[model samples]
Structures are given as structure tokens and as C-alpha cells.
Target: MDENESRISALTLGGAQERPMNEKLYMLTLSFSIEGFIRQVLTQKNWEKAYNKHDNSLRLTIKLDIKNNGRIIESIKLIRKAIFFWTRNPKIDHRIWIMIVKDDTPFYPLEEEEARQLLFDFNRDIEIKPEALKKGKNNIAVFVELSWGKHEFIEKNTLKKESNIQQIEKD
Candidate 1:
């Protein structure tokens, strides 16, 4: 590698602790673009860092405005349910759930600890994607980001093959 490329790479990664802080990913705003959103949820991950910055491992008491339309789409309903569960039972693993809320109410009461966990566990879904409401603008599209990590057993390819064979048998 060239001197400049190697130097920049080293500065950004190697001995990061020793280097003076110039750039901070935490400070950067998340994407509002449609494609960026889909990719981040389905593949690339940038939300996890934001989650950690906000309050890692803290339960949350969320009350965000949800889209009002009745599309019964992927994110609209799922997000609302996730928010309700997290609000009611912050102890639930957020790394596995997503909550959706409407903007009308504000009494998102919970112990401080519970509220923190509410936000932390929200990252369970490494693939948080939101689709625009079809009918009208009244349907506010809110996307709750999720977490991704390395904790899986068995090869995905093998599992997929077995599941496909099993489905055929059942059919």
C-alpha cells in the first residue's frame, strides 16, 4: 500500500486509542434516504453504533408518533407492537423485538432502568427496514433499528437446504 493510504488506514484503525479524536462516527447523522435505510437493515449496519451512543443495554419507555394509515405493512404494525411490549415489559430482549407507537399519548411511564432497557434491546433486529405508506402522507413511516452480532451455530446453507427439503415433505 502507498504511504498515505496506509497512514490513513492506520490512523483510523490501528492504535485508535492513542490518536487524537478528529472524526467520530457517533456524531454523524443516520441516513434518511430510502435505499440506505433498506440496506442498513438488511445488510450494512450503522445503527448499532448509534444505539450504543444513545444508551446501550438500557430499557426504554418509548412513545413515538406512528403512521396512521391502515396498510398492514411490514414496519407499521410490527413497530407499534414492539414499542408497546417494550414499554410494558422492558425486561423483554430488545435485540429481538421492535416497538411502534403513535404520537398521541405521552404517558410512557417506567422505572428509569426499565426505560433504558427499552431503548437498548431495540437493536435485536439487525434488519430494521421501513416502507412508505401507500394511501397517503397520514401514514408516517417510522423505522426502529435493530442489533446484529455473531452468535449462530450450524451452517446457514445446510440449514436452508434442510428446511427446504422438510417443507417439501410436509407439503
Candidate 2:
């Protein structure tokens, strides 16, 4: 093939196709459920978003503002289950791991040992089988054991959970 043809082929080659509407909804639901944990750790209602890449895989990073929370430990406790659920290999659809970035920058600064401990607690909360976590070169990752399909599904349980958590806190 010529250069022009080769360029066209590369552009067309690999990309994830759109998932079904229901599946998209499911993926969003799953994402929302996982993101909800940030609320407990953050003083703000919204957290920043970013995509992660390592080992040739795309992971999502929810750069949470975990600074203001008086105690990051308790917030970690509350969302332990939800974090594991969303980060699991496959649940209501979607296959990806998650990392909650907690830093003590202006106050405490980043510490891998502390971060590892928090990750350990969160990993234990997951109901399914979880693999031993290893700290990657730049960061840490808690691996989940399961093969997730490309179907991308997110269930509708998020709204109810959001409401429940909201009601409990009493803004």
C-alpha cells in the first residue's frame, strides 16, 4: 500500500464503537456510583476528571479534592464498597480500574505509604475477589480479578444511592 493508503488504513483501524443506549446508561450509572465516593472526600460537589494510560490501557482518574475533608480516613470508609464496585473488572458493564488521588499538598503532601494504606482499606471493602495491589512507577493500582466485556453497561441503582446519601447528610 502507498503512504496515502497506509495513512487512511491507520486512521480507520481501531476505535471502540458506540455502545447501545441502555449500555451507555449503565456505564454512566456505574461511573456515577463510583464518582459519588468523591463527595464524601471532597467539600465541593464536583470533582475534576481525567483519563489515565498505562500498560497500554485507558483508565479514568477522578482527581478528587480530598484536601478539605477533616478526615480522609472516614471518607475512605464510607465509599469503600462503591469504589471497589465501580473499579471492579465488570459489574453492570464497563471494564476499568479507578484511582482516587488524595494529596496533602498545601498541608501534608503526597505519601505512597499513606496512600497504600488507604488503598488497602478500600480494596478490602470490595465484595468480589481482589488481586494484590502493586504501586506502579508513577502511581498505584488495585487490580480486580474478572474479565470485563466491551459491552459497557451501567445500571440504574445510582440515583437511589445518590438520594440516600444526600438525604442522610442533610445539606
Candidate 3:
């Protein structure tokens, strides 16, 4: 028999009904337009003062530690940059930030409020998986995707499972 047929036969033999395993998985993605986002922030009067105080340089560096019950399990650092702009003259520098989490890194979910605080005053979008939203459930998997624009930040969540059985079935 061919490989596909053989595998099907093996699974069907003996009347042993096999059920798909539900392995938990999570992922996150963040996107934003660097120039558009920076310009949006700089337009703010308070932010303008802050920018000028820093020698007209806006330092963009964010560090987030994913925690469970106040214990950190994972840490993520967002895109970092130093942008210089003049208030009198409006000119946008061409620098964009794009990042994707590596597969090997551990996944952690932050509360909506916590995440919001981390990205406060910045234009960004965040996405997370459904399974990661369980209340009072720790050790859950989550994925986050972020995209940013001018005066628009989006956060979304999605769920995907990765399991050994699924891998074997595909093979």
C-alpha cells in the first residue's frame, strides 16, 4: 500500500477511535508605521516639551516582563529607536519598527490594563489568542499581534495549538 493508504489503514484497524489532541499554543504580533507613529506623538504639546528637553531626540525603548502572579516568566523588548524632529518644521524621518517573536521564546499574557499602561501615549495595536484569556487560569498559552498607525492602535488575540499528534498526522 502507498504511505497515505497505509497510515489510514493503521488508524482504522481495530476500531480504535482516535481523537485529536488539544495542545495549547499562543502567539503575538505587533506592527506600526515608524514615521507616522512618531509624528503623531510629537504633535502632542506635552510630548513636544518632553522631546525638546531631550535634545529633540525621542528615545523609544520599552521593556515588558510577562508575569504570572507577580512572577516573571518571560520578557519582551519592543522595537527601540531614537528619532529627532523639529517642532517648527514638520518632517518625518523614515524609520519603521517591525518585530516578530521567535518560536523558541516562551509566551506570556499581560492583562489588558497592564498592556495598555506599557504602551501608553503611543500608537500601537495588540492581538492575543482566546485560550490565553481564561480568568484565574495561569500557565495558559497566548499569542499577541500589534500594528500601529497615526492615531490608531489595534490589539487582537488569536489561539493556535501545536501538538505531537498533529505533527505525526501531517507526516
Query: Predictions ranked by lDDT, top down?
Result: 3, 1, 2
- Candidate 2 displacement at residue 51 in angstroms: 6.1
**Per-residue CA lDDT of candidate 1, range 17-62, in tens?**
1112453111111111112221222210222333434422212122
lDDT of 3 at 29: 26
Lowest summed lDDT window (length 10), candidate 1: 159-168
TM per model?
0.16, 0.15, 0.27
Q: Score candidate 3 by TM-score against the native.
A: 0.27
Off by more than 4 A, model 2: 1-78, 81-109, 122-171
Error (Å) of candidate 1 at residue 163 is 41
Give one clash count per candidate, in the order shown.
Answer: 25, 6, 20
Model 3, 68-152: lDDT tens per residue?
3344455555643333334232232322221112222321212223222233233222222334344544432212222332222
1 or 2, which is superior by TM-score? 1
Better candidate number, 2 or 3, judged by TM-score: 3
Model 2: colliding residue pairs: 26-153, 26-154, 27-153, 27-154, 93-153, 104-109
lDDT of 2 by residue, 20-93 (tens): 54322111011122222222322111111211212221122222211111211111222221122123333313
